[model samples]
Target chain A: MRSEIIITLVGMGIVTYLTRVLFIVGMKGDRLPPFVVRWLSYVPVAVLTAIICPMIAAPEKHLNLTYDNPYLVAGILTTIIAVATKNLVITVIGGMGVILLLKFLVG
Target chain B: MSGPTFDRRQIWKGFAESVPVMVSVFAFGLVYGVLAVQSGLTVLEAFLSCVIVLAGMSQFASLPLFAAGISPLTIIGTTFIINMRHLIMGASIAGKFTERGLFGKAAASYFLIDESFAMATAYAEKKKGGSVRDYMIGSGIAVFAAWNIGTILGALFGNFLGDPKEFGLDFAAAAAFIGLLVPQIRGKGDILVLLIAAALSVGAYLTFEGSWYILITGITASLAGALVTRDEK
Candidate 1:
């Protein structure tokens, strides 16, 4: 198990690094297609939403939209604060504060 | 003019910009470490994963599969898909590094995670004469150090630290990603794409295994963006 885990981690690291440097190495002097650049522009926002939303709506490996789910409540609150403040520090603090408060009260 | 060399100011700028999000990244890293240990990984294994793989989303995504005793090949494939965005990220930033030699580019690329890419790209577009390579390397190193240190603390003391989710630390990554996502919402098309991605991501999570939802949501949402923006173009 230990050796297998090591191999897996090393393999994953190499693959990740290779993918990161792929275009830098191969497309040294080439211009990316307009459509491809446009496509890439959307990747960050798309990937971020994909990663964040499910986390809020289904944190415990299942869809839990109920009020009891602190993550759901905090997530929604954080979204609102994020849009309002546009500050990462405040948003995290606000979200974590609310969830911690809820945890203490609920417990 | 001075010869080409790494700019200390650019590095400082990168380090300063990353400070805002580093806390959350650290917290996120802590969550991963705790979860990795809980999923049967030793402290060393979890720590190495943070330092080596260095891709937060893919690392988190792989944990469940590892716990399930899945084959390493399949797990790697899943991580590969989850991290495919880095390819696009690399492509987007490739133009800015044209002057960097192969060794410099390789070193700069080694640490290009999402937060660093965001900061580095913004700096590249706006800076007067600084090295984008140094800025990204700085940002990446800062995040890299924070993440690995957090992981070590989490792994070594995870048994003593209790459950991260209980204190809402587990949501740190989601919240951090949200902060990053909000500023990028530019138009009605972007909003629609976000909604579609969110819905699809949740659907994928509920229906599928591992982190395939990320890939599915990413592809479908990007396609939606392409279609919606087609009229604007």
Candidate 2:
């Protein structure tokens, strides 16, 4: 493995452990401010949308909004499945199936 | 003061309740492992990531950035933000551990994943006197074992599978993100945040040159959404 990769993994591990351990050990009885909790609740949806939007909209690092973009079509379908089913396993597996079928027919 | 005794019944109950969740976690881990190897991580690196990081979403989010050759610091920073929710989860679970000693609390904290936290919370609500800590540890161990095993097997399979794009695995990350995000959208505020983040992130990807878009959009959109919906309740 590359040295940089190792450093990144270890850094990630330390920060992750800190996030989990801090409140349990140091701030046993304290509660996070309600606003902070609310803000934090929004983090996952925002960050996840940020990540997913580009991958689907610009899979080639440039805009491609047509059916030729398998990621886009498959992503939309995946989102529907996810929202409707609310099951991770089904969404992922179903998404992959859509992509494969698209690639087979279009690509 | 002595720590609470390790209740085998509570542990067993926790482990049993986690079986359904374990299946999904294993599936997620399998995808992560495959994507990790496909994104240029060696098998050892992929396996180590599961063992060390243990946070599947952050680990999955890092793959594309890592594959793009983004700096280590940026990837690590992204990991921190992605896992920040754990702080809230830990705080909520801490109430159950007031009787636990420092060592016991610290040790139990290591096993605190999303599934374990939810399982412990539900167990506490359902049962009157059973040990939540023991339940958490049991569920944690079950999740940990499934995740690591799935990762190893998937990593090996990915190593042999050659190109991920052939199998349409390239879209797995986006698919996984959607699966994670959609379930969390409970109100108009969340939808607003999602739209804003999506627009800003795509714009940033086109305008900027690096992965800073994620961090910038995450912080800006969430804060804006929270403030805008502050009076909704």
Candidate 3:
């Protein structure tokens, strides 16, 4: 019970409810324009990429072209699995393996 | 009589799909609860975190932002950036709801998790006219239940987790993220966008100063990929 924490949670809950409920209550059977819809379709991938990519390879405070990068190894493995089999479980296993390998081998 | 709008069958379906994932996500909630509580969040706050956001990645991302003393404005902005993916998910689900009334379409939008979307789309592809409504409730039940249960467990028993370091629950966010992502890449649009976004987001993190950079790079890259295809098809 911190008052601030409770307040924050309430704020978070209201915002979340609005975001979710707005979609259900507002859109119903309606639609956005084709141009907007087309743009919207790409938003997920774009935002996700912007969010996660480089952090994998260059986690240091600064970027480098050096050889030691755990994310690069993980990325390569993840990509190969994704492309070859399109199997998520395999790719995750691959990433985990890379994570463990990096912990043991690189450090 | 026709089934009620929120029928028991659909609720049960939702419950079933959600419980298994709850097991996995529970570990994560434990991690979150311990950290958030230690950071001075109340149990109610921790519980509400899951109910409100209902997203692992965003909530995890938000934690460091809070700890770092980032402004609410910055936190909101970053979250909006991270979550812009839902806009695309919403758009993809848009046409699927064409047959639904405005209210029905609106309701469908709230339950747009990866599993729900995949299963519902599969159901739609298999059957004409589609079970968009049914699938939404069915899959949504699982996602919703899993999230709530995981959060509550984390709040109640988070201390018993002993050390998150030993169990590697920290990886839960990345692991769960990739797990959900891997299972969902079914088409060219999805693949291309995912690949580029992955690359660019990593790149941005390497070069830029903040987590927001990752979101920026990812959004730009995905938008580029999505533009490669035409809507007419």
Candidate 4:
């Protein structure tokens, strides 16, 4: 267990350093290829979907999910408000409210 | 050129924005704290992991696999691909702040995350000057502090929560991602790319039985998405 922690920690440290160093060395800040810049805008949205996939695919795996997943409900509500209002705080609060309401109703 | 040192003021503004970010990061930190211990890490290690990596999604993604004795190589590779967005983000911001010097860029990159990038980009697009930089500082410091504190608190009392399953922090990640994604989801090209990546990722998961292969398919899909979007330019 100790070896695992040490190894993971060191690996993490290296990854963090390398990630930053590669960009710094490449002087990636200079105007990117228009081809790449156009692509970059999509990266966040694309990567996010990638991250989202594993979670939705295995809802019952690590993080727990029940028949009534308030978090899920609140998330849907949050997405709606975020788009409609284009406000992060409003969306977050709305989601929190949804969750709180669900908790009260369910519990 | 005598420049007034506004360092103190900058620090203050940084602290101010950090407060709310602290709230969100701390909430996630609470989950990480408990989960790290459950994954065979000690309290000290768990708290420090937050301090060091400072990336919530990557940390959480790596945990369960870590517990199952996945190879460090796989962990590192998976996390790097998952976080490849950082390369794009850092690239975009670098164009604006290169004159700030190498050290400043490195320092800035350390705290770079989805929230910070979104905040910075929006601020720039709005043509706000100092507040853009100040907001980043504020959010970063706040997230850092809140994360550390949350880890310690979670480490101490996380077990008492009995099971986070009850609260369903599970949904928080997806919720957070959706909270960000749905706002930005636009155009048929965007929808098509997302669907391709989604389908391929799900297929990979079923066949490979792990999230590892999903990275390859996801990136390939993203490249294809970019190619299809090119003619529009």
Encode model 4's per-residue lDDT on B73-119: one tens digit a residue.
77776666556666666666555542345555556667676676666
> What does the lDDT read for residue B88 in candidate 4?
65
TM-score: model 1 vs. ground truth: 0.71
Winner by TM-score: 2
**Candidate 3: lDDT of B94?**
59
Docking class of 1: acceptable
| Cα DockQ of the candidate 4 complex | 0.29
True contacts kept of each: 0.67, 0.83, 0.37, 0.35
Order the candidates by DockQ, highest first — what do you get?
2, 1, 3, 4
Where in model 4 is the C-alpha error above 4 Å? A24-29, A38-107, B1-6, B34-41, B98-100, B118-138, B163-187, B230-233
- Quote model 1's TM-score for chain B: 0.72
Q: Candidate 4's residue-wise lDDT over A1-107, tens digit each?
A: 37766777677766865664456345643755766655655654566676666556544443334447555456556667767876443554465566667777988
lDDT of 2 by residue, B115-226 (tens): 9999999888875777788889889988988899888888888899867787777887778888888988888999999999999999998889999999988888989998
Off by over 4 Å in 1: A52-71, A84-97, A100-107, B1-43, B56-75, B98-101, B114-139, B154-159, B164-180, B183-186, B209-211, B230-233
Best by lDDT: 2
Candidate 2 ranges with C-alpha deviation above 4 Å: B1-9, B231-233
Predicted candidate 3 versus true structure: per-residue lDDT over B80-120, tens digit per residue? 55555455456556556544455555556667665566666
Proportion of native contacts present in model 3? 0.37
lDDT of 1 by residue, B50-98 (tens): 8889998778767766776877876776676657778777877887874
Candidate 1, residue B118: lDDT = 91
Screening candidate 1 with a backbone cut-off below 3 angstroms (N, C-alpha, C), the clashing residue pairs are none
A1-107: candidate 3 lDDT, tens digit per residue: 65554455455544544544454445545666665555555665565444344445555555543557666566555666656655434555565566666657777
Worst 10 residues of 4 chain A by lDDT: A58-67
